[model samples]
Target: MNANELTIAEARDALAGGELSAVDLTMACLTAIDAGTPLNAFVHATPEIALDQARAADARRGADAGALNGIPLGIKDLFCTKGVASQAASNILKGFKPEYESTVTSKLFEAGAVMLGKLNMDEFAMGSSNETSCYGDAVNPWKVDDRRLTPGGSSGGSAAAVAADLCLGATGTDTGGSIRQPAAFTGIVGIKPTYGRVSRWGIVAFASSLDQAGPMTKSVRDAAILLGAMAGHDPKDSTSADIPVPDFEAALTGDIRGKKIGIPREYRMDGMPAEIEALWARGREMLADAGAEIVDISLPHTKYALPAYYVIAPAEASSNLARYDGVRYGHRARLGQGDGIVDMYEKTRAEGFGKEVQRRVMIGTYVLSAGFYDAYYNRARKVRALIKRDFDEAFAAGVDAILTPATPSSAFGLGEMAEADPVAMYLNDVFTVTVNLAGLPGISVPVGLDAKGLPLGLQLIGRPWDEAGLLNHAHVLERAAGFVEKPRKWW
Candidate 1:
């Protein structure tokens, strides 16, 4: 097997045993990345940076080697990697390279992980499909016929890179279903750590209350390993919890016996595809086969999740994105003869932000407007509280974790819903936004494939700060399902 195709644990063992060198592993990935360029998984390829880090890792391969030593990873564009273009896949941030690295990247680097480069993402993490990215859509490696399929977004590039074995793993920030949704679409593991579980410092803000950095990898075990390095408290991010980050890899005992996995009835939406329904049923059986008791549960407020997420996410986005005017770093619009500061701000933003971003910004600004604040934003906040309460109630009732479909369907064609009503695209996040709203850890495990042979995943949402338990449950499901199919090397 190629070094790039090795899972984190596998590579770690090989590297430690002196059977493989970090330079060889990184080179294998760099080669795969070059060949995989048609997929656009990597927006920026940092070959020199990767090799330098690999050499450094080789030099430190003794007792002091860190947990993620020698792993090569693709960082999402949302992360501010010092001296690297961290555009968040938006035109506004074009040519903007941070002077400092994000807390997650810093932790990974300290753990000896190599950066392959920045991956593509949605503009300001605004869209469900990767079509909204300034770098164009990152194509899903799984294909049918000659049609291009989306890798999902806004972490589409991360998903594509990991699934195609272009890297051992990748950093992905989840705001809504950005991580899990794409992971499902690409037949990989993507976990969104509980809000504030991983420090958000240096990660470009999307929805401050909802954004979280997590790992997207080929397997649940890899996710656990990568997440371990990515997670921990940071003094810089106020929301970062001071609690300890457990050894996530050691927690994957794969014994979910006696665990109560909730099967929320609200997730069985009307008009859902038969394949998704079948996939969910198979997931339930797999867990039950693994000795987990599946109980029917209710999260009534789920019906309001999509609406609440749209309102809340966009509102936070508006507030967070206000700092990108022409006066600051990044793209600045040229001024006309009489254009003043206000005109510059307007022109810069209008020229910088993509259509989806502008739409959300406008909606956010309108909802936050004095006249409509109570009617929209405030009401959404109240609904969000109710949604969170629904999950709390389920957990209080002895549910160990909640199981649901990761997405309504498998990967769709690139432009499938782009031109449709925007609401159609929003529906893609229906199963995921609730986890973020409730501030819980959630993971998507590939369970099976649709009739079209595309992958389908089941989500496992755990109690707040219970990623260890969540990952265990997912590991059990992953083992039971035995989903070993990989996307053909079409890219």
Candidate 2:
């Protein structure tokens, strides 16, 4: 395979065997990123930094090389990469280069990964279709005749880059299905570890409690490799769990002889497309063929996950985003006659935040307002707890994992849903938000193609802190499905 097409593990082997150098791999990815500009996958390209790191990795060969030595990775704009413009795809933070690196990025770099630059995302990780990005919606490389589709969001660019072979893998943060949905849409693998599995320090916050960083990669094994480098506790983040890190790649034996995989009845929503149902059925058969027992289960509170997530995510977002009030770092409005600090704040925010972000912030502020707090936010929290309890009950009954469709449907055309009611866009996360709400590990694995020839993914939700097993089972399903289709590079 070409350097850009090599998966992480394959590249690692080639580098170790002296078949290729780190600089060659990094340059291949840079060339692909530059060539794939039509897809808008990467908002920033750091070829110099990537080369420097690649050289350093080559120097470290046979000395103290790390597992990720000589690997090239794309950083989703949400993760704060020091000296790189980490905007989270929002205009408000335009030109805002962080002085410190996010814990996840720092760890990856310490493991000798090279950064190709910041990938695009939804503004403040707020939208489901990546249309809310200040950089314009990231177009999925997978397309129908003359119609470009969404890569999903807010990790859309990460998905697009990986699927289009612009990068072997990328960092993606999941909040309300941002990572998994995009991975599903683009025919890649994405995993959102438990809420605290990866540190949140220095990652631009959308909803603090719900946000988690994970990996988007070409295959389940690559996801395992990247996740091993990404996961672990950090003292800097209070919410980060103080758990021991495991060798995620080593755990992928692809054997699940007696695993109980739950098929949640609530996931069978009305009007689900026939293709999605067929894909889910195929995924179940694949897993069952691999020796996993498929059991019928019910998450009774699943119906409320979307509504409750909308209320809770935005409420936290409103509080977290209040810091970017133009008085501090970020874009500030030019003052006019009679315009005081208040006017500056209003105008700067009005000009900075995109429409979907403004709408969510307003919804959040209203929900958290004194008069509405008890009625909306508090009730949503109660419902959120019930959702978690439902998953807890299922796991307590011996279900090792839950299987469902990763998305309601395959990749839709960009701006198709955004032009309609915003709620219609929110429905894209219907199968995904519950995992975020429950703070569980979930992965989207491409298993089949739909009628339009776009990929369809199956989601496997796992017990908290059990990502090793989750990835192992996903590898089993991935092998059984054996999906190897790639987008016919329109870009």
Candidate 3:
């Protein structure tokens, strides 16, 4: 197996047995990244710094070895590191370097994992195709024709790096479907924990309520391990959940027998690719073969989820991004003499934000304006509550998890969906967004490949703070599907 492609569990066992050193693993991944530069998977890399951290991990192995003692990992550019660029994949923050580190990255450092530098992402974590990155978009490794496949965004670089073995695991943020959708596109595993489960301090804010940091890896066990390393309460973030963090690595027993999994009938939408529907059906059969009972259920708020999510997320984004007025931080406009403060704000924002981000902020401000607050924002909040209630009811009804297709279709070629109305792009997240609106944990695991040979994914959503259950179930399905093998590299 490729070194960066090893599962966390697999890597840990080998490391403990003295079969691999952190330096060796780090070098292997670095070599892979060097080879994959044409794929545009990494925006920046710190080879010397990464090796130094790896050597430190190797030195601590016998004395204070933790689960990730010798692991090499990637940090998304969204998080602030003390001396790293920490640019949120936007030109606005090009020279912004924080004096502090993000809670998740700090935790990963504390976990003895070697940091392999920052990965690329959609500018401000805003796009679905990753083409919105200030850096170039990441290419999917599995396209039969070697044409560009969106390794989906805003975590596209993380997913592409992990899928192509550029990183063992990369951190990702999910506001809507940033983590899970990209994971699906790249045929990797990604989980977005319940809102507030991971600390947000020092992560460049997109949407306060929706932004969450999680792991992108090649397997269920790696997801659990990375989650264990990244999740916990942080005094810096008031919203960080104070609940005791479970050892997610210990929960992967691979025995999901007798568990009742719900197959939400409402998720099968019109125009869903036939291959994806078949993949979802095959997922149910795999869970059943593993002794799980599959039951049909309805999340009646399904229709409202995407609309509600779009409203709330963009609203929060507008408020959160208001801080970058171009004076105290971010790219300030070079104003001529007599330029007023209001004009400075306008020019700065105009130069900084991309078209999609500007459009979203405009929609957000308008919705929150007195004329439409009640009609749009308030209603979306009510629908968001109903979405949560729907998930709560299903879990209360004894469904261990909800199974659905992670994406409605396999990754499309670059520019294939360019002329698409933004609504069409937003609908790409239809199946995954509801899970975020409900603030429930969900994971995407590779289930099968399309006839075109691109990977397809099945999503498993669990109740609030139920990451352990989600990971175990994904491993169960992952084993049954046998979709964890390496992809053929085009370059």
- lDDT, residue 348, model 2: 92
Misplaced by over 4 Å in model 1 are none
Task: Count clashing pairs, candidate 2.
Answer: 0
Model 3 stretches with alpha carbons more than 4 Å out: none
Q: Return the TM-score for candidate 1, rounded to 2 decimals.
A: 0.99
lDDT of 1 by residue, 406-480 (tens): 999999998889989999999999999999999999999999999899999999999999999999999999999
Please give the RMSD of candidate 1 to the true structure: 0.7
lDDT of 2 by residue, 1-491 (tens): 67999999999999999999999999999999989999999999999999999999999986589889999999999999899899989889988998999999999999999999999999999988888899998999998779888999999999999999998899999998999999999999999999999999999999998999999999999999999998888999999999998999999998899999999999999999999898888888988988999999999999999999999999999999999989879899889998998899899999999999899999999999989999999999999999999999999999999999999989999868998999999999999999999999999999989888999999999999999999999999999999999999777
How big is the positional error of residue 309 in model 3, measured in Å on the Cα after superposition? 1.0
| Structure candidate 1, residue pairs in collision | none
In angstroms, give how far residue 269 of model 2 lies from its true place: 0.8
**Model 3 C-alpha lDDT versus the unseen true structure:** 0.87
| Cα-based lDDT for every prediction | 0.93, 0.93, 0.87
Candidate 1 vs candidate 3, lDDT winner: 1
Clashes of each: 0, 0, 0
Which pairs clash in model 3?
Answer: none
